[model samples]
Target: MQSLSGKTAVISGGAEGIGLALAKGLGALGMNIVLGDIEAKALARAQEIMTDLNIPHLAVEMDVSIRDDWQHTARAAQERFGDIHMLVNNAGVGGGMGALGNLDESGWRWAIDVNLMGVVYGADTFVPLMKGHGEDAWLINVASMAGMAGVPLAGSYTATKAAVVALTEAWSTELADSAIHVSVLAPAFVKTRIHQSHRNRQARYAPTTAPGPEVMKMAKGSAQAVENGIDPELLAKRVLEALDAKETYIFTHPKYRFVTDERSANIAKAFDSAAESPLVADVAEAPMALGFVDS
Candidate 1:
């Protein structure tokens, strides 16, 4: 929709970080909010913040990875808000730090479950309601900058993001004729607790040992990069703008375009010369572990 005023929104992982930021932003725009998170304390804290802001909101303890959980969350949002206009599939976890080979099956699965499957569940659960309403609606899936490019270390994360991008593209095309609009947010970094998410991860996946020294060093750099990354409020604004524009691909920062542009140029040149880049092999070979498979 063009305006968020009086609209209803459900935000997965709304307890903290960018999720909470988007909730507050949408609330300030006069939207009714339903915030979901697995962490009770964080949910409570986020609710308190909403309360102080005089925003009408409800916090639900939810595990976005489960289909039943998403069903329940969708029902709860409709019950509380009367109608749902937006769904932000923002819940995600950093699986672990390592090369593709170093990432174990469990680690890979955990990342895919939360990062990829969570968004899938949210979209599959909410899109029907949005479509049924026959009103303007939006589905915003939070992918990552890594989703756009194959970074060296975060293999599992990149793979899941690629899935998200593909999903968003497919859904956007599929729903183009409908009132529901789909968009994917591929941000490089933002000041958030994603780095520490490894500590609070659920039982589905836990590395036996802490990230190795090399991994730790890379993670440190990544965290620092995020801390200096985009402002969450600004990102929130971009999200709303993307919804209004009906833009399928929502990118937060302009600086990140270099790699994407370089890759695109290479692809175009290869198309002209009948030669292709080897990046396809890396993408196809990246490990995909759904940590909750046995659960």
Candidate 2:
């Protein structure tokens, strides 16, 4: 995983934002690139950028939520650039922005389908192709800091992202013996179109309920925060560094470490409280069963 020269990478959502930045960074390192996105114009612009850089690349119109789209994208990547060494599940949507009961069903579906299920589809479609390639391989799933810490008015987005983080951890263990390494990128905030993700929302998944005033205010504040956040290019560089190091969890902003620490501390305190219960010793001595792992 140290060297990326001459490798091939497939990036979903590669037309813009963090995806495009990663494409640029990886292409600069001599990796053949396959950029996939739902936006045709943006894909064209991405291709033009790669062409200007003289980087060998391909741009494909793809909707990561659709399994058929993923299948087609996989076929295209393999046909254009032999075996795929890296798969970046970067396509995501920011939807379901409201309180639990106030959120729209469509928004929940959109977020879960794109952010969580999309990664699942990508891994299922691409991992087999990457195995035994006689070269280093990796899987990078773009999650968020919201996955680690709860953020108001972004419940569905946080839920899906947290699921992605969990999936990445599980995949890392499952693929531990294989050449394909797995990592989850949990960036706090970046100057990306994710704040305005609704601009690209599909017609069928449009929200049925309008956001409340408080929810609208929170969304605006989030967009402003993202507007003043870290540059995508810098985040891209850091991602490549993490890939080279084979780090499982990649965090972009150090300032958010305190938030994660606090979350972890709260969970530990809950465990401590549980241990103090009268039933603690009996529960501790009982055999624990993990569905995915055998003792």
Top lDDT hit: 2
Give the per-residue lDDT of model 1 (tens digit) for 1-295: 4677888999999999999999998999999999999999999999999999999998999988788989888878888888898999999888766765465567778888988999989999989999998898889899988888787777878889888998998888778879887889998889888888876578867675455677878988988988898789889988878767777899888788996898899888877654355645334523545322232
Off by over 4 Å in 2: 132-134, 285-295
As a TM-score, model 1 comes out at: 0.89
Error of 2 at 140 (Å): 0.4
User: For each candidate, what is the lDDT?
Assistant: 0.85, 0.90
Residue 22, model 1: Cα distance from true site in angstroms: 0.6
Q: lDDT tens string, model 2, 59-159?
A: 89988989999999989988998889999999998977987678688999999888988899999999988985756788999999989887877889999
Clashing pairs in model 1?
Answer: 108-289, 109-289, 109-290, 109-291, 110-291
Clashes of each: 5, 0
- C-alpha-based local distance difference test score of model 2: 0.90
lDDT of 2 at 254: 86
Clashing residue pairs in candidate 2 (N, C-alpha, C atoms within 3 angstroms):
none
Q: Against the hidden true structure, what lDDT does model 1 obtain?
A: 0.85
